[model samples]
Target chain A: MTTTTIPTLPAGRTIKLGLSRIRYEVKTYFRQGDAVFFSFLFPLVMLTIFSVAFSEQSFGSEAAPLSAAAFYLPGMLAAGLLLSGLQNLSIDIAGEKGDGTLKRFAGTPLPVLSYFIGKIGQVFATGILQAAMLLFVAGVVFQVELPSEPAKWATFAWVFLLGVSTSAILGIALSGLPRTGKSATAVIIPIALVLQFISGVYLGFSLLPEWLQNVASVFPLKWMAQGMRAVFLPEDFASLEQGGTWDLPGVLVVTAIWLVVGLAATRMTFRWIRKDS
Target chain B: MTTTEPVVSVRNLHKRYGSFTALDGVSFDIHRGETFALLGPNGAGKSTTIEILEGYRDRTSGEASVLGVDPGTGGLAWKARLGIVLQSTGESGNVTVREQLTHFAGFYPNPRDVDEVIAAVGLQDKQKTLIRKLSGGQRRRVDVALGIIGRPELLFLDEPTTGFDPEARRQFWQLIDSLKQDGTTILLTTHYLDEAAQLGDRAGVIAGGRLIDIGAIDEIGGAEARVPIVRWKQDGERKSVRTSEPGLVVAKIVAQLGEPEALEIIRPSLEDIYLQLVADHAAAEAADLMENAS
Candidate 1:
């Protein structure tokens, strides 16, 4: 055998590979019709249906009442982020694991972190597009007023980042729950739907029982919706909150906590090959 | 990097999941530039051994080394030295054939030209086609292309031609032959005994989680198993004799009985020897079970 010297591998190449992974991931995501329709367009469809159906209705206390479009806007935005980051990733990754994509990647020289970068990058790219479409429909088609104050926009940005980060990590961690690719949608959609309904995406948060409200508060979606409300609704509208305040700081804190928890969970559960394989 | 050093070595590897043993006390070595065929039936631990060597799965116990590094803790540099084609095709169907190869090619330090690999696997026409749209044999070609694009020193081909047509399988064999000429050490697992006979310099036959036999391709089942058998009908009785010189045996028989009816000499091929080996092992196992029961 001809003796060959193994080079000291470049440490910085992972980020480059990760960046390339994003391109393939985004391209692949748009090609899957089901994923494009459900994950990317589900929120817009829900927003349209609820806005037109309840055009005459208003939610919250009379002193701080908000129109249906305004009421559902924040809720749908939160749900959209959750769907893009958590629900989409969980199902997509589960399918990868089931179909041998993850197994193939595990055998290659590709870093595990690069695969994650691709996944999270796909979610972030699609999440932005989904958020934009939802907001556009709310602002023009439904005549819902968006936040004008730069401070409010600033709050929206952080809340959006935190929510997406937390949900995406949790999505990867939850991918292990489904036993097979065919079962992923069944396992993930129900969890996403339940979180949506209880987190006030489909109904008024304050209308639920106090006990249910407490239960909702324990998850990140409720805080995410509350944060979006702080951005889009009038400042005095905080009077209708469970605590009679938007609790913007609490929103950041809770979502950040979930982000940390999600990171830990993903570290423990993420696998290239299934246990049974 | 001595020429005598084995590229891969395993010492009494053992793996178990709960009560089921996947691989038990299996050991072998692949030298620098030889194609080593690992022949086995389904669930006989072929993939488990390959996966453990690839670092995709962990072994419960025993030591395994690939390219002088322990696979369980092999770094990216060590991994870059090897190419692997797993039993199952795993690339996403969404990406075009060329796109998938290009993506994987970026991961390695010394990668072959993507188009060259495409041609090598006979997928030049399907380069722009989405993998999902390709036929099963075509998708398998993509898997083979990806395996070679890394230009690896050691390649693991796990049942690579499982879905290929006869023509495609022949073309794949030629591709493997070229790789062999390049002095790339390969460890291949396949159900096709002809493929092993055509490509392997040496072989290891595994059965029921154990290495039943290991040696040069022609010598795997031992001399006794390969002895040519002469069969003839005499006095309404079927009879056969095993001998190294079937021609001499037939001459004696012809001289004795003036050409007895239904006479033939059967030269045991590798497939025949392999089957006999597996059957003998199964019979031994059944007898062991019976003995234990009593």
Candidate 2:
């Protein structure tokens, strides 16, 4: 006979199950040699290439090794998180759904919210670590100095949080569209390149055509990267670029707007599974 | 009170995806403590109805009550009372079976002891093994472990023994019998009719999004269900007869045949009755469609 006893807990609440799921998600995330390749190795390789290749593009007196690298560091960091939150997240989620993992979960008492919290939590924690690693390497290897002002550092933290949250929701939204891993990659890789090219990750907006710059400005990538540069790079150096003044309010607003839009898209596009497809 | 209410009551339930009517007016009630097997072919609205009753989908019209609560708006307390064992898969296989059971234990207010439940399902030795490493049967036991962890008042078993070998299937039936003895109401859906006869207290046959028959396992097809067909060849003359009292018919036939050439009486199994019922249902539906056209 099955014997059961009630556990002690508050009467009504969705047990966040947050910490438990995060622990499991991270454990599984690291176990896959493939995930480690995209989340960690990809960003490190990109950072090295940009810092080395553009070592001679001078910003003030020195070659752009430090300044250009520092300016684009946020984009590369966003790129690492985008790999975790957008590129890798969408494909893996779609694969799990196709593999019947999500259907298995539907049988449990675990809340629907747990999957999102656990996955995004893993990405967010990794995002923070990726950010820290970038800062450590930039400071130690390239000898780049962050702005001495306390306000800029605080601004950097908040903007990073908002940017990652927005990206994570977009990840879940995209997962609903593809049914297979091959299709997921086809959708993700091109979007990644297009956003990186236009948002000043590879080349500055000044070098891109006016029409392209105008298009890139509409994306959250541009604002997130520019906000990070405002915090780390010297103000006099940053002033050389147009609309380049440290727009703290603009960074917050753009990311916040994306966050809302991402959530709405999630509700509309999300499917537990496409029964017909 | 003579069976005051059914454990599950679904009335005039309808569901649509855009213009397609996935389920059109499906209705049935499962009585308390009865293992009512729902049998249907694929795309016959079997899954759609079950999903709605499980509170995973919403109905476009009509009402559904599982354990006296509308599943459409049912909350955690109500959900806690139902055990659902889905199709077995290795998706949650990264964790050991014991670890997996313990993790699910945290969700329900009252949950069966993880170690004890593991042993009940004959998985004690394999408790430390990752779910992925276990055999298909053992992984199915894990699915069972998670389902019954909460000691649910009602259990929904969806094709629980689909991949099981004969030995494993019998063992699973034993586990189910123990659960039934403890007064857990069960609603099962399967394509296997022998399984239904062996385990179900009652069975229901559904076709074309509607339930055509529901009753005790032996009486599912009414009086005609128990009747047997006697056949024989005497002096090169083939003969056959269908009668309700098979014993009397057999006795009379035996006297006439005098142990003559291959006299035999064949009784209908649940599988036979079930197939006949569904076939008759389809024929009736065709006739109705024809009549309406005229």
Candidate 3:
């Protein structure tokens, strides 16, 4: 250990550092077998179950025949996004906090904000990839039709981006609530399962009780599923919606609100170190 | 040494959590190219003080400057000058040792070569192993590797060798010694008194959120505290005397006893003084509590 002169590091090195963090996050996520399974395989399993049980069944009246696979395809995609962006992401972040990973990062020169940006980037990328896989399976095996026109695809892009961003941010924020790794699943999964049932992912929004619809509407998952339905479902299917219309603009407004709220909550609740109390 | 500005300095630092005080009016300085050790038991505020210096926690009051900048508002450049090895780190265990080190090296503008650091920590053979597959002691080597990768001007080691075996601990000491030789200012906290005596130029003992004593390692408890006890057998009875000058006492005993039987000169080890200091502090604290209760 000879005396090595340390060069003064340049200020504002967060960009490069954050990029490195993102690279590590992506690499680590792919390498972990459980993470790979949950993000990619678990969603596929859920899609298979729903499609097998309700493929030929049609909902609503004889005027419009909406097959169960088609109706549930959009909902399944929304569920996939939620599973990756919210459930998996939150548990991972909370697990890091529980095990002292966040605390260790706090001691480094790397900015805490950069660490979060890296995590969010990983979540967003995984969510997109999982959504694409689910879409492929639904379109090919289940024979569900995707959006044809450019406008509907555009809707899918914004809704997917906004929904994933909102959930990722919410995951980062809710990570602070879990005290340990053992409790992270308990803390995040119950909320995810409840939202899946009430937010029209496992069941049709119109079939759910009116009061339940109103309650679920306040969450991002409901808006995400509604937006996806608008992008995939036909024009007449809007009659079965809560407002008896697609309400694409309302979906955008609701999701945008969630994006803002999630970011704010993350800023307020993110903890670099887990307190024992 | 007095003419040079301290690389790390603290003045009346305080940290409080509601009604509880973690650090109370603690002050110290580590000169450039010096290895300063902080010795204390659990909850003695050693970690709280170290965290404040590392910019991981904020102080309730008083001033602290590391590398001439306040840690509370230190920017990234300021942080780049520090190498910190926490007591217990939670690392993502999926990555290999080399991959983890390579990723961390990018955070600094100029960092030591990753392979060189891995070799310095004696982990060259295990660089390709996943962190989770490594033993507890081997993982600690990774922690140390990350700490020194940036060639930091000052390294903060909080119990850097807690789980290490005897050989590993000695190797770690040599690594620290080499870093010190290269003129990197070091501030470390350890519960092991021998570790402090072996590596520290100076040591401070903290108890009950206060720095009770600070001085050169050999003189931490003061001249009186370092007094040696001379024990000898006289007329089939044991006799002992404590004195600052052991040689003089021994000669006098020999002159009186015509070569004393079973002669022994026992000096107070750092551990002995440390325990005495903590015990004294606990007694004082209990008395204060009793007085307040009455």
Candidate 4:
């Protein structure tokens, strides 16, 4: 007869499982050409086009001026973060749900937390790499100066982490909206595009109308872009920002709030299986 | 491998979706190392019962102990001892067969060898191929490989061979036979009576959210259902009669006809009993509905 006994797993096995999940996620992300294009290459191409088209322009006044390429670099970073954490992650999860992949995992011994950890880890790592590649290309090819000081790098780190976390969490929450893999793109792409435009990734925040700026400020993507600018741009260049200065505290608070809200919403709404499935 | 302690014991299990009752006080037990087949038609609450036992769904009110632990509160330790192959899982499409099996193995305390599992599922040649690229039958084998990879003591297979060719189905049966030989208790739900007859030592017929009948495969519908039918030619007219003792009936017919030609004795197959049970349950449900309407 088959004996029934609960066997205690060795210590640190959950960690091992999480690490292996991360490895699998990373491998799958790289293997899919469309995912790589959107997360990494697409942003670089956008940067190249923007730099070549508007290199001669200046964003702020003469005293603390910034090249268009330098000003656009931080926006590119924000764009990459949104692509990895929001667009790609949501579609991937929606596809998984539609195909019953998440349900399969839910039935297994693997903890649900481990699956989220793996997904978040994959997006975080890829988001960072995409940011690094964008920064490298902007510095080398476009002659854009990145954040050099330790404090600036620290600000960049927290902002990037919070931005990615908020986006990934919201992505997971929104993944529950699409009933099938085919509908995921239809649901997510328009939202992502609108968010990208309003958050000043495609156009400078200063160029947008005051009413548009007010609407954009309610979202984490705008705060993420502002925080990136605070790191990469000169202090006096804050003249170009709303209220005539970079509100560093406001950026932190908004991103943190979104992170908490997104986490809670995802915990409530995320579905492992599609309804019709 | 027989034991008095049933590996799975369920009693008064009830599952409801608002006013709709999926399972109404349905109950059964599966002994250790025994193959128990739950035969049911579509929408018969088979999946709900199985999912509840797998700890994937909440029951309205019931007592279900899988492997000595209440499945409602079964923890990860309890889950590790169970393997569940869902109806249709196409989620691991991006990963190769071998990669998927290797990853799932990490979740278990004592996983089978990855290569051995692949070979056992007859997917050794396709192990390196991505799941999406493999044929439907091959992908089902991958599901089975992952299901058995954990070396689960009690395996739950939900309509496992829904879309397999005859040859593939036979091959899959052989794979299940090997797992049975290893003393893994199996609880499976399938519409195929042949599959139930071939794999199940004991079988249950479920219809209209109730387990109406359950017993050994050969005697599922009771002694009356097991009665054999005797047929013979008499004066160029064909006649048949069902009797508990076919020998006596055949002897009587032979004596009356001088010699019985084209004589045949046919016992009720499992399929016959199953169909009768389902039909009876449907008729009872319709009658109940009519009485309530009045």
Candidate 5:
């Protein structure tokens, strides 16, 4: 063993823990092939399934063939983001927190705030990859044409970003809900399925019962999906419904509410380790 | 006891969990550069005290200072000076030994060089190997390396050598000694008495949320917890006596028995002292139980 004179160091500096945490997150996220394959890839596969299933169906002459497919494309994309963003995020974060990684970080000079920042960064970066993959497969295999207008693309970008961001916050908040990893899976898996079904990923919100639609709209998922359908489909496709236009303001409001709720949940929920909790 | 400032000082610390007293009026002092071992059995409030010191748990009442600042409110400056080696690592990862060390080093302002720390822990051969591939002992070395890489002035080691082989344990002792030589103060808690004896300048024994004994390693058990026990055969019958002066007792026994056969004078080890202390606490509790029953 070599003992060299360690140059004197000051202890007050902030540890750039975010970089390490982000690296760990990205690396570990890729290593979980089951989550990557099922959570991210399965949604792209779902896009094909949706496009093919809805390609020939006509919505009582108001909607043309493949028009319903276009409307649900963005919803499926939002679902893909949420699968990893909310479902996988909650499960993985809860698991890590349960396993003492968070506690170890608490002891270091590494700031916890940085970890949140890094998590957001990694999730968004991975979401872009998911978006790219979804767009590619949708264009090629599914014969689903993306919106070519700049205004619609702008709307799609805003809603998609807002959707994933809100979902990520919700993920962090949900992490504190389960004391153990297994319990987290039990809590999050059903919630993910419910979000997919009720939020218009598998079908339009109009197809669900009025009471369930009202209840689902109270959450961001429904508004986020509706907003995406508005963006990626024809301009008057929303008017083809009972409402002439999708509730743009509602998506903005619900996503904002989810963001605040997610942040508050994360702040309030302590990790598995507590001094006397 | 030369008027030197204590490195760690706690006064009247009280912690309670809904009616159960985890620590009650606990107080002690550890001087600079001294190894003060908090010795206790499971559920004896040792963890509570250590957690309070480590700034991981809050105290219900009273003042506690580690390196002259209360850990409960201590900020980054206070935390950076301290290094803690937890009982276990979090996960087995594919990150190489050097990679993990370097990653941990990034968290501190002034960390030891990555290669040097890996070498210091005697993992040169395994430096490039993934952490998951290493043996348990090698992984433990990585934990220690991360703890000391920041060149912390005060280190908290909790049962650090629990899973180490004998040779690795001895090497760990040498590393600790070298740290002491460099003027680092360590607060260690271990169940191993020999480790306490070999490393601690003073040992503090805690039982039932109370510090029952605290003194030099040699003085804790002898003449305090238990008298030295002398054993030998006396005319085909084995006899034992507890005495303050074990050497004198041995001399007398040798004279009477003409070089006593199977004779042995045994001083109380940290384990013996620990057991007696716990048993005494249990006996007191039993007496209290009987009194309350009546």
Candidate 6:
């Protein structure tokens, strides 16, 4: 029989649970072949295809020139972040909701905050691996040089962290938008694809129309792509940017603001069960 | 907690979704160390009532206390003392049974050994197999194992044996019987009346969103509903008499017709009484509708 007095849990129990959940999330995620191929491999495959296609081309002026492969490196990295953080998390969580995983957890003593920590931790871990793979392929096959200065690497680290964080939170918020698990990929893929294109991942940022660039500027993906470009491109390659400068400050402001917005939206929308269920 | 204090108390609980009333003024109490079965047909609000008590859904109006705390305001500490096996299995299909159990065991302060839970559910042979590869019955055992792994004081089993074979179900009943012996307060919901008879100490029968009867498993439909009937064929007509003294009625019949043809005494089973109660309630409701229409 249940005791009249409820027992208090040990201190740091939630943290321990959250940390263990990360292992579960990662293990389960890698087991799904479809999730791995689509979220983890799609960007790398695209980079390989694009790099070979533009092998003969050169970007930037003679003073600080860049090969076409190096130019597309940052764009592919940005797309990888979006795929791993936003696209993957949204679809995964929506499936969890539709298939009753969230409902099961809701009945347990697991804290909702801990669940988020596990998810975001997954995104962070996968994002690092995706970045490393992208960097390796770029360096070995394409002979693209990475930044050597500690400041440039420092910028890369923060940008990667902030971009992944913002995308993950927004993904959780967007999981509520799909009506069913079957329809989640159908709804999320188009949105992610459109963001990538508009944010200068698949196409050149300056080549796009002013109105389209302005629309992309309202989103964090555009800033994230620009920040990646700052870390990887030559100093004089700033001329290719819309403002003829690496707007690192602007990237920070926009990504941080989206992080806040994503948090607010998730708080408002996340549910263990669907509205109709 | 004392055995006299109800582990679960529900009063005037009502739940409405739009114009549809899912649960209407349902009330019951389940005491400590007792298994209370909520029996109903599909869409009879059994799940809704259970969900409200499990803190998964909110009631429109009601007073519900589970383990001395209102479910609406219960925290993680309160949830830790309860185990819920939802109607549909909700575990991730990617992990093995042992891995899933180990993961969930970490959530509770005091949990049963993962291997012991596995052995209890008779899944020792399939413990290392991925859950997705398991058969329906095996998957259900995994569900039961997860529910008991936390060593919950109060366990809620919602249609726990839905897909089990007869032999597996019997094995499950034995496991539940052991848990009962351990003094766990349990709330079970199932459409199988025999399951209720076998496991429940008391039952609440719900139909059309209302509890039609509540009492001990054998005495649920009242003494009147349980009266034995002596039936016979005489004068080319079938005759039957409802009587408490079924033996006396048989003797009187034998005296009158020198052993009437095809004579037999019919004692109502729980299933029969339950069906009769639901049918009578439906007839009464139809009459009320007709009067209102007129």
Which structure among the candidates has the greatest lDDT?
A: 6
DockQ of each: 0.45, 0.21, 0.38, 0.47, 0.28, 0.49
User: TM-score: which is higher, 2 or 3?
Assistant: 3
Q: What proportion of the real contacts between chains A and B does each prediction keep?
A: 0.59, 0.16, 0.55, 0.60, 0.34, 0.64
Query: For model 5, how does the per-residue alpha-carbon lDDT over A1-277 read when each residue is reduced to its tens digit?
Result: 2222223334333335666767866775776667788776878788777667777765434544455456567778878778868887888778777766776776777666767766776788788889888888777766677777898888888888898899888998888777776688888888889988987788777778878877887888888888877877666568643256787987899899999989888888844367672
- Quote each prediction's TM-score: 0.93, 0.84, 0.90, 0.91, 0.88, 0.94
CA lDDT, candidate 2, residue B226:
64
Cα deviation of A178 in candidate 6 (Å)?
1.3
Alpha carbon deviation, residue B106, candidate 3 (Å):
1.1
DockQ-sorted candidate list, best first = 6, 4, 1, 3, 5, 2
Question: Which number leads on TM-score?
Answer: 6
Off by over 4 Å in 4: A1-5, A55-67, A147-151, A179-181, A268-277, B1-3, B232-237, B243-264, B287-294
On residues A187-254, what C-alpha lDDT tens digit does candidate 3 reach at each position? 88899999999998887788899999999988888989999888888888788889898887888898
Compose the digit string of candidate 6's lDDT tens values, residues A118-229: 9999998888999999999999988999989999999999999999999999999899888988799999999999999999998999899999999999999999999999
Candidate 3 runs further than 4 Å off = A1-12, A55-67, A179-181, A274-277, B1-3, B232-239, B243-263, B280-294
Model 4 / residue B133 / CA error / Å: 1.2
- Per-residue lDDT for B142-172 in model 6, tens only? 9889888899999999999999999999999
Question: How much lDDT does candidate 4 score?
Answer: 0.86
The worst-scoring run of ten residues by lDDT in candidate 5 chain B lies at B1-10
For model 1, give the RMSD to the true fold: 2.7
lDDT of 2 by residue, A109-179 (tens): 56667677888898898778878888788778866675677887788878788878887887887787675
* DockQ class, candidate 4: acceptable
lDDT string for model 1 (B172-209, tens) is 99999999999999999999999999999999999899
Q: How accurately is candidate 6 docked according to DockQ?
A: 0.49
Clashes per candidate (backbone, < 3 Å): 0, 1, 0, 0, 1, 0
lDDT of 3 at B40: 89
